[model samples]
Target: MAVAIRLRQEGSKGRLFYRVVAADQRFKRDGRFIEILGTYDPQKKGENTNIDIEKVNSWISKGAQPSETVRSLIKRQVKAQASN
Candidate 1:
């Protein structure tokens, strides 16, 4: 199966929190997942993203493809880390 690094919606209806996960491409957005790599809280003032870059990179190195939004988040994470 082609694994995809993606997001799963959680929290309340109006206020959504997201879990960044690795899952099968055929699975539903909020369905079963292989791993919970991290979280994204857009409501936070700063550093609203919390991810384990090592884990993300590890998964990618193993042939996991990240979704468009997840790829963007990963890029931001990489940039943030580089700036630190």
Candidate 2:
């Protein structure tokens, strides 16, 4: 089975919230997921991303590929955390 780490969209039409999840590559965007890693709220100003780096790293090591946007988010979050 092809595993993927990607975003699951939620919330209302105009407003959007996202959950970072580990799921099968064949599943629909918001379909069943293996686990919930964290969340992303684009509407928020600062610190809109809340992710578990440990979990993400584990999934990656297990061969789960992240989406383009999720990849960038992870990089940014890790960099911010390192600076603190």
lDDT of 1 at 11: 95
TM-score of the candidate numbered 1?
A: 0.93
CA lDDT for candidate 1: 0.93
- The TM-scores, one per candidate, come to 0.93, 0.96
Instruction: Residues 12-51, candidate 2: write the lDDT tens digits.
Output: 9989999999999999999999999999999999899999
- Count of backbone clashes for each model? 0, 0
Q: Candidate 2: worst 10 consecutive residues by lDDT?
A: 1-10
- RMSD to native for every prediction? 0.9, 0.6
Off by over 4 Å in 2: none
Can you give the lDDT of residue 41 in candidate 2? Answer: 98
Writing each residue's lDDT as its tens digit, candidate 1 over 16-82 gives 9999999999999999999999999888878889889999999999999998998998889889999
Model 1 CA deviation exceeding 4 Å by range: none
